[model samples]
Target: MTEHTGSYYAATVNKATDYPPLIGDQSADVCVIGAGFTGISTALHLAERGYDVQVVEANRVGWGASGRNGGQLIGGISGEQKVANHHKRDVEDLFGELRWAGHAIVRERIQTYAIDCDLKYGYLDVAIKKRHLREFEADCRRLEKSGFPHEFRMLSKSETSETIGTDAYLGALLNMGNGHLHPLNLCVGEARAAESLGASIYEQSPVLDIEKGHRAKVVTERGSVTADFVVIAGNAYHALERQLRGIMFPVKSFIIATEPLPENVVAQINPRDLAVCDPNFLLQYFRLSADKRLLFGARFNYFGEDPAVIRKSHRKKMARIYPQLADARIDYAWGGTIGVPINRVPQLGRISPNVFYCQGYSGHGVNVTHLAGQIMADVVAGTAERFDLFASVKPLVMPGAHLLWKPMVALGILYYQVKDRL
Candidate 1:
């Protein structure tokens, strides 16, 4: 079995999963690929509706980006504006409710299943540049126009510092509708819920190929599963589907977790327990853990998984935002890959009539994946209204990009870093 990475999430998971790998031929109403948020979420949705579902994963549940993400339960899908524009509809008119649909699902599931993932409310979209503040103002207006239920408002430079104990941001937009949580715990809890509903999840069973037919066959090394439909939810870790490659760039993001801070430090920094993020394309995000550790994340040039190397680079970055944390001990450091489409849209399409795929959430996986799962479930049941909205905007494939992704992503990040400064 491919073990979970040496992440703080792994060390603190509620219950470690040890599902048996696929060992023989099996059948189900639907066979889902990958066990991260996307696949597990889809399986739970399908199982709830009484579909016989099975999920296959190369590693443990949420072992990929789902387990290792910054855990910001952000709202709004990436490239949503482009998707709405392609249909000649105003974004808010078309997706005002749909954009926050995933957030609703997350909240509902947490309540229904009693999943304790340190889920918290309140988030700050901090601004380092004037343009970001303008964008936040636009966002605030949109929220008001939608009759958004949560308490939300813009904060001035001094108010921002007072709220978060940081003078690094010029201003910020505080939204209680969005938040953060323990992503891995939520994923595993949902997986357990799906299992309770009779969904069969096989861990360490990497899909080798898909034989397309009226009943598609999902082939693994030790076994195979025949199902009426197959949904690919691997995201950036996927490698079996040749057609799915090149449609998105694999971008690496790193995070560092500090030792539980002293009560005084926690009081002076993030006492309200809000998830904080910047507006840059190469963004920096941080929040307090349930135990009061500061979990900070950003995009760095390195791609390896050496904790020492990650800590060295991220400590400097974190110290910049909170200089008092300069000597603070970092307890954990890790990295994970996220899919970034060329146009920033989440790609939802099919390899064949019965073989569907959903990937490339950019950095919006934590929120968008839940919505994608429901949409995938709807698609399998012959309802494609929401599915068509995303699929209609075809993915812009970059030829030979996956093979050269290392250098390609490096250039792209360098470009964004320069742009973030402007």
Candidate 2:
């Protein structure tokens, strides 16, 4: 059975899951093939609406990207513009509430289910270049025009340094609507909530095939699920379906956690406890963990999981921003894969009449996955307005991209690294 990666989130999980693997034939109103955020979120949504849901997983809950991400609750879909252009609709009319719809679902679940995942408001979109600040000006205007209730403002260079204790960025845009949380705990908590509502979850049962028909049969190693509908929520980790292959590239990202800092150190850096991300294709993001450790992540060319290697590269980058952390002891380091579509849009469509699939959130999985779950439930219930909006845009497929993903991703990262410098 596949286990959760050696991530800080995993080590500090509220509770480890030991769900039984699939064993025999089963039936349900819907069978979701994944236990990550998308699957659990969908299952929880369906259970709330009185659907008999069965979820099959290849590993423990939140083991994939859903559990091992940067945990940034960033607002907005990845590629909303492309969707708007393709449909010839105004961007705001196409996606205003839809952009932050996932954030609303997350907040509601945390409160309704009493989930304790170190939820906090405040985020920074730091600018590494002057052009980025101009972009922020436009974003701020849009927020103001929309009458965004949350506190948001653009910070000057000096103000940005004062806020994050880093002069690496020229400026920043602070958005309270966007924040961070403990993703693994949130995912596990949601799964537990689904269980309480009568949804069945089978972990460590990797799906082998899907026999599409009136009622699709999701085949696993030891058992099979024949449901009226099947939902494929496995993003980057799943490779069983041929239809999904080559549609998106799997990009690897790594993160390192520092030991809990001294109170003075914490106050000196990130006193407000805000998540920080720079505006770059090959960007860097960091936030203080609930225990006060700095969790930093970035995309590099390395594909291996050796913590030592990850720490060596990330520590250097971290120190470049905060010199005081130059000697800080690194406690944990890990990596995960993200499904990045070529066009940067979230891929939501049908593999068959009753077999639905959703993937490719780029790096915005935490917030978007929750909204996607709701949309998936809506699609199952005959409401496809939101689903159709995303489904209308066909994925820009790269032939044999999956087979040669490693080299392709490496080249892409190199290209972005060059672009970021320009």
Candidate 3:
């Protein structure tokens, strides 16, 4: 009865949020567009700071990639190494704090709000090639140097198989800090938490236009929000703002959920309940759900949402890693878009002095968006140290990215697939 994609997450959420559609003019200290993770998270942060906040969503809350992702809470921002290189001398001063800020925010929100999103700890980055192993080794040293609180270890080829019950990976880097959760539920819970903090959210209200001035006016067909500051938090599904179109490539990722497996099968695979990801440009990630279904994800260039097609393409990829599930029944198949900047840096900057936009987290939305939310709130509250660090870096754009995204993404995928073999 709504616009949300028919996915397993939608079917199983305990209860749906019922925020009203915007019908009359409203006002707040801050108005946020796109009520996904970023918008809700920012609103929560601002409300916690005693700022009056209002959030406007084009559809239901988290009705985009924020809700449809693989639910992997992988640590570190996308392109941390490259972004840190922009400020090499301060790498230790900032990168260490930036790397885990999102993870800390997530853990704090879960406990503080009592969100029931099946939150768990543990993750494995599986190595597909020796180079991947080297990268993992390098990352392990970084954590060791920083005195990471959680456990992290580099696993041997045989140890990788023993840990995951699959021989598909040559090795793995296990990090207890990275983990998984029911993302849709987490988003809804955060929205509710924001509301309890005095933030107002309007659902099913597509932002028609924004009038920029000393005070920004976020307009909808039926209502408008006048606020001192406005934030664009739509990420990849954002098409309302023309200035943001070329800043990132809107790539698609698909996923499928197998029928709940027996306990014996679950024990054989992913017994530690760790989210698993591979080291490839076109990579696959998977983990067991709260109910024991294997939610497998594959990154690719395709953009359509035909369930049969996604099921077919993803089933083949999933089989390559876990042949035991070759014949497993697929209960759900869906796709979501990711905003990927060419430089792979998360974009955070101002469209105008009083209006800010944050997007292009690549596939690192779950973790980075939380960090971006905090940074955006900080900027709104007259603190710009963290926000300026990201905003100052120029976002790399693919030429004609808006007009020729599909062909460009196809070529990009081919280039990576070829390079992965080398």
Q: lDDT of each prediction vs. the true structure? A: 0.94, 0.94, 0.90
Candidate 2 Cα RMSD (Å):
0.7
Question: Model 1 RMSD to the real structure?
Answer: 0.7
Worst 10 residues of 1 by lDDT: 1-10
Number of colliding residue pairs in model 3? 0
**TM-scores of the models, in the given order?**
0.99, 0.99, 0.98
Give Cα distance to truth, residue 263, candidate 1, Å: 0.5
Which digits, one per residue and each the tens of the lDDT, describe model 3 over residues 304-376?
9999999999999989888999999999999998888888889999888899999988888888899999999
| Clash count per candidate | 0, 0, 0
Candidate 2 clashes between residue pairs 3 or more apart in a chain or in different chains: none
Model 3: colliding residue pairs: none
Runs of candidate 1 with Cα error greater than 4 angstroms are: none
Summarize candidate 1's per-residue lDDT along 1-422 as a digit string, tens digits: 57988888999999999999999999999999999999999999999999999999989999999999999999999998899889999989988998889999999999999998999999999999999999999999999999999999999999999888989999999999999999999999999999999999999999999999999999999999999999999999998888988889999999999999999999998889999999898899999999999999999888798999999999999999899999999999999999999999899999999999999999999889999999999999999999999999999988998799899999999999899999
What digit string (tens of lDDT, one per residue) describes model 2 on residues 40-131? 99999999999999999999999999888888999899999999999999999878888899999999999999998999999999999999
